[model samples]
Target chain A: MARKILRGIPVSAGISIGKAYFVNRQKERRIPRETIPHHLVAIETQRLRNAVEEVRQGFMDARARVPEELKEHGAIIDSHLMICQDPKLVESAAKNIEERAITAEWALERSINAIGKAFSAIDDPYIRERMQDVRVVGDKIMQALIGTPKPVDLPAGRRVLMAHDLTPADAIELELSKIMSFATAEGGKTSHTGILARSLQIPAIVGVEDLEDSIRDGDLVIIDALKGLIFIDPSEDELAHYGDRKYQFEDYQKAIVKQCHLPAETVDGYRLEVCANIELAEELVQVKDNGGEGVGLYRTEYAFFNKSNMPDEEKLYEEYATLAEQLAPQKVILRTLDVGADKLLDEQAMLDEANPALGLRGIRFCLRYQNVFRMQLRAMLRASVHGNVAIMFPMISGLKELRQARFVLNSVKSELDAEGVAYNPDIPVGIMIELPSAVMIADTLAREVDFFSIGTNDLIQYSLGIDRTNKHVSYLYQPLHPAIVRSIKFVIDAAHKEGIEASVCGEVASDPYCVPILMGMRVDGISIAPQAIPGIKRVIRQIDMEECIELLGDVLTHATVSRINTKVRKRIFKRFPEELSFFASLIEQDDITEP
Target chain B: MEPSGENNSLEVVVCVENELGLHARPAGKVAQLAQSFQADIALCVADQRADAKSILDILSLAAPQGTEICIKASGCDASEALEQIGQLFHDKFEGDT
Candidate 1:
């Protein structure tokens, strides 16, 4: 048996076996707290200044290396650079060394603790989070003072990188070539570290409890990121098993990519459009490469974030125009400015609502800020003339909200007409059937819109009243729940009745076990992350429509989520055992007591 | 022995005009510019006072957008310090947009 096995939330999927290397640990180091002689005070103060200068230079170098497209990372590094030279930190530590006659490391630790105390009393959670920046900067200075190796100074050869947490700066500074896989003590599914790992196509796990204490530097480890497990000091048998699993996963990956471009048609000749959901224009290459038919959901919020002012209409026009031009023949559905809740814009963060998820967001935020909304609409309308562009409004709870949004779009169109500017007058406008309220009134909404895109991620959350990111209640985030399954089915059926197309976008669309059931419901299309396209498409091509309808019948009859999950899992696992081994499913057997 | 036009102490009220308030980037700019002047400068938000030359101190103030801050400076270049620093708030700390 392995010495120990640790579990965490897997963000990126893959496997690797290598020696562990810690970039930084959460545990406190044994600092030399002894008081220095009065004669040594001047020397200690100079040492502190030199350490700060060294760390400041490192941040400067990292900032310079940051690509133009990743300006967000550069901004974060700028903040760290400021924090490194902040007088409250460096100057106070210098005073601590001079007055208390302590070592530079000890003085710096004292300064950090003092800043942490002040930060703890802050009411705004966003401001409070800035304390982490101070700590990261402080740690770098301490490392310099202690003569510890920086992350860039990793020992020769590839290794599994570990850290308490990876800041944007740390993620940028690390040399990717020397790292095989990485795990962190902090982060979630949407964390930046996970995004980095996925883009890098390496295995990664985050929020790993006990990741630091369980493994030492240079210990041989197996990172089973596919299942979010770490085997420390694995036995010979375990190594052989993982070695085989890794080979199979890579083979499966290649096989899926080779056949990704094929139409998503079942054995019985049933077809469904598979598209990519993307946030940035830069990801358009990934979309085409992954064989996505078009952009299903082009999240427009990226342009609005990390800016001092909202992006102007002309700037937005250029971005959307470029996207529409590049994907000229292919359709792109642009979902307008969905801010608040988890993805807070600067202005919205100040609202500091008691319940932001239910608060002003999506179309509601857009409606409230007409200037911002009007600018986006004008941009989208102008870009529509460039290529196949469809506009989408998110979080439409009812007819009144939908009508209000349409009113604004109509006004924008009229203004364009009066100005004699060119735009697609008959551009398809759609609403995301994300709210349970929207699902209930889908038939009513279908008459007014071009299509229906069911956002199951939010539908499940609002319907179940559970936040999946919240660990204590995440077990209750059952996507296959009877209410959820019924909600999706009802919306699709409603769209069909009104002679419109309905597509599913979210994790449900990507899951192999769930896609078949959606196919049975006859969802017109699906939009998933670009990377998940090939595997999901392969699953679609391999199955028969007859089997999908049968599985849906079985799933619907089972009243409980666990029963539905069990039945679906067994059937899907039997038919696609090889494919199932490589894919992670939303339907887990967590509540099932028997086979 | 002071020049007639020169002032030893100055105070000016400035509102945070940037959408993100006085976050790290803005705070860093304030500190960097303040360090260049020889004035003993401080920013007063509500009852709290933060050193204008310390990013940590300014961040701890946690002043969001639209909050009024008083820039206080006392030195040979105090008037020059207030005018230039207050201008940063007006311009949203340059290159922000």
Candidate 2:
């Protein structure tokens, strides 16, 4: 048994075992508060000034060393530099030292406390958060004054980095090459630490509870970021187990990357189109690098959000045109704007519905605002001339809404025709079969569109009558439930009956255990995030369609989710033991919670 | 905001045009440029005032994009300070969106 086990949200995927080295442990230090002699007041003031100068020089050096790719982090360093030298901070501390004749450490602490008090009074949460930056700068000065500055410089070797909360300045100043992996006590899924770790291709876990308290500076720790687990001072058996696991993970990574560009075909000669679902046009490079056949679902909401005003039609056209041109000849299915619910526009916020998920969103929101919808349809039509561009509409409930969307598209096409604008008149039109109503009547909807994309994430949510984000009922989110399996199969059959192709583009498609079942259903294609492509394609290549079909047949007989999960888990895990260890599966999550 | 009749005192109303508003990067730029001149500069968002030379003071204002800010300065180079500082806002701090 290990001495301790800590769990966190894993941002990057890998396995690493190394000595832990904490750059900034959040353990509160006991300050020696002493009243200085009148004679030594000038000396204490000088000491304070010297520390400030040293820290400022450190910031400048870090700024100079900012890598070309990480230039964004440089601006954050400049903010720290200004905060370090600000009179509101430094001058106040100096004033405290002179007037009270106290030690520099106590004076600085008092100043930070005063600033914190002032900051807490401010109502703006963004500004209130700036107090953390003030504390980070203050901590640096405190370390300098205490004469044990910069434990950041590691001796000589790679180690797992631990921190209470890593600031941008600390990340910039640290020698990144020597760090093997990282575990931070603070930060959520989208934290800076996660972004840095991912860019460096190192394993990392954030929001790790008791990370600083459980592990010391030199303790041997294993970071199983694949499952977001940390084992400290593990037993010999555990270490050996992890040692083999790490070696296998690395070997698997190399193997999959080398074979990624090859077709996602089963051993028995079953072929599946594997595409990438991306939001930004910039991710095309990633798609190509990961061996994606094409862009399966291009979420068109990003350009519409995060700005003060709506994007003009011209800007939208250029963005789509560039994307289509870059991925020329390969299909790019652009999903029309699906906003509201979790992501709301300025105008939508005024409505303020109690249950947004069941309210105006997706096609409903687009149909209500015809101008915005028409503008997007015009851009999509205009961009279709550049490459194999197809337009998809999200959250369609029935035939009427689909027709309304197509009506708007036809009107835009006629307008472009009148203006003598060039576009592809035969641009493929598709709809995401996510809503339960759409799945039931998919046969009718399929006859109207060119293709079908199964959005399993939303389908499972709406079908199960559970919001997966809600903790209380999230346990009910069974991706491999008999109902979900039947729903997916029914939609695929419906699409096939109408001579249309059906693809799965959701978390379900990315799972190693779930992909086999999807393949068994004869899904025409599967669209997933770029990073998941390699491993998923590897799984597809290793398996046979005959066995997957057999597993599906066995799953069909099971009445409960637990039974279906058990049957699938045993069969899939036995077949692909190596792949199962690395990839986090939707089916595997059920084992821990279910009886 | 109007400039006073005194040659030394000048004021300009500039809108926060950056997408993320007057966050760290823009606030740092404002404070750094403010330090170069000998002007007594203050930024006012409605009734609150912040010393223009201090990044902390500038950040504490928490002005989002489209918020109107009055840049007040009084010194020998007050007009020049207002002009340069106002230009930074118009340029969106000359960095990322």
Candidate 3:
């Protein structure tokens, strides 16, 4: 007889056989109330102080041990250390022990809890996550005061980390090679731990509330991280099935990579430009590795985020220069400072509002913070001297924003000249036509800006007033909405009429089903996520522009979602009948296609 | 500026300093805030008033730095809401603050 194990949701898509490493807990014990020797109180106080210092040093050393890529989060850990060393927390604990005659452990817990309550009162989620950091440092301090070290064991061999929840420190300390996967009982989509896990490419399953209690040590487990599914101890047949599935997935990923260097053309010989959207300079390697034509959009906001203060012009210059150098000749369109509702700059920006998605953000934010925006613009201008760097402004609603953004660019260029910094004077400036207003005035904006990019993500969100982030209303966030299609079509036409290149760098552009519509609209180019490049190209090659235009004509008149979906599906099925049959056969035979 | 509000509307004036005045993000914020109340809200610039609840309408105004704009709100909570909205402009909507 074989035993089975049950656990949390698996976030990454893969199967692996590995050992289990149970997370260790720090020993917590209450000090006896009877231990109050008045003379010893001073010694105990001094001992606690020393212990706090030791823990603080431990945290600092731990931060230093983190990889350079992850060192950006050092400020978060430092903030946590301050929470531990907060005079208010220390004084209250000491007062409680001396006056109420409470145990040191109890006194510490109460004091930390009080501080945590204060943090909880903050309306911002970013600030709220900081509270957890405070708790982590406080817990370590308490452990140190009690003379207990939180034990962490790095298990040998490929092992999955099984825990209730992982702190940011826990994630940073993880040895990449030994870890096969990770599953936790608590965490959300935006947790730093989860983000780190994805960045490390480690399979992870989070938010499995009862996983800690259900699995025993040494139990066999299968984690399918991509589908968020977890399988406990499996039958031999099940194990073998997953083993094959794992190999197939790896092979598929390799196949996608192999296709990277190949031109994104269909069997019929239609070529389409497939570019990558990069967040950091390091990600340029993946773009190059994948044979991306060029970077369609370089999100500059990431440089400002995950830090205490704004990055200065020189700091930003270095970052942009490196990226521009790497992707030289191939253009990099840098979208300046898209921070707003979804990404806040500071605590005060995260004000309580009826709707945050519709709040001040993107170019609007950059405009408000001109000094910061100008620094970014200056950095971008300087980087342009290194390579073909183009500038783009996000969330342009009309001609005014576009004109104003262009005006700032001119000023930055002139300032760079006065300072004798080498810069590109003719760097093409673009606007992201993401709002209906921008779409309506696309002709005017296209004339002013050098190029136009249709940001379908926000275009659809604004056109429908449906918050894509909100799960309940996300279903209504349809990209193929008649109004959205018209808006995109309008921008594309407007850009073409003004002789400006137009491309789309939205999730919709990557969608295979929507490629035909994009082609029909006569977009100059389509920029998609790196992963979706091959499939989108395959779709593009199979269909002719004339046929796509015909399909669009039929699609534009459909009133309901189902009607539009059916029409598009029918058009796609007609164009790629063979591919559809192949897919159906593959699905029938294997029950899954890795791609 | 002439009153851009409808009948029985409250008038509140504010100055624009956000470089890309009343553009996407800020316009979206204003729209989101304006939609919260039962009253209809509108923003005025250079004798033009656009619905505050409509991002397209607000953005078209193209209000720039040092531009004086009037906010008008009508219906329930219009007076209080107009004052609150006026303070957002006075505070520059927390931009660079």
Best by TM-score: 1
lDDT of prediction 1 = 0.86
- Tens-digit lDDT track of model 1 for A1-595: 8999888767678999999887754433335555789999999999999999999999999999999999978978988988998889999999999889888987998999999999999877877999999989998898788785444666689989988887543665688778999998877554556756765668998878898778777788998887778999999999999999999999889888888999999999999999988877988888888889899999898787645577899999999999999998999999999986667776678888888889999999999999999999999999999999999999999999999999999999999999999999999999899899999889899999999999888888899997655545656768899999999999999999999999998778988999999999999999988888999999999999999999898899999987898899999999889888766566752532210
TM-score of chain B of 1: 0.90
Query: In lDDT terms, how accurate is model 2?
Result: 0.85
Instruction: State residue B59's C-alpha deviation in candidate 1, in Å.
Output: 28
How far off is residue A317 in model 3, in Å? 1.2
Cα-based RMSD of candidate 1: 15.2
lDDT, model 1, position B42: 95
Please compute DockQ, using alpha carbons, for every candidate against the native two-chain complex.
0.45, 0.44, 0.01
Q: Residue A435's C-alpha lDDT in candidate 3?
A: 83
lDDT for position A281 in model 1: 90
Residue pairs clashing in model 2 are none
Error of 1 at A181 (Å): 4.4
Inter-residue clash pairs, candidate 1: none
**How many clashes in each candidate?**
0, 0, 11
DockQ of candidate model 3: 0.01
Candidate 3 — which residues are off by over 4 angstroms? A1-228, A232-237, A266-269, A347-354, A566-595, B1-97
After TM-score superposition, what is the CA distance of residue B32 in candidate 2 from its true location, in Å? 36
Residues A291-340, model 3: lDDT tens digits: 78889988886767645577888999999888888888888999998865
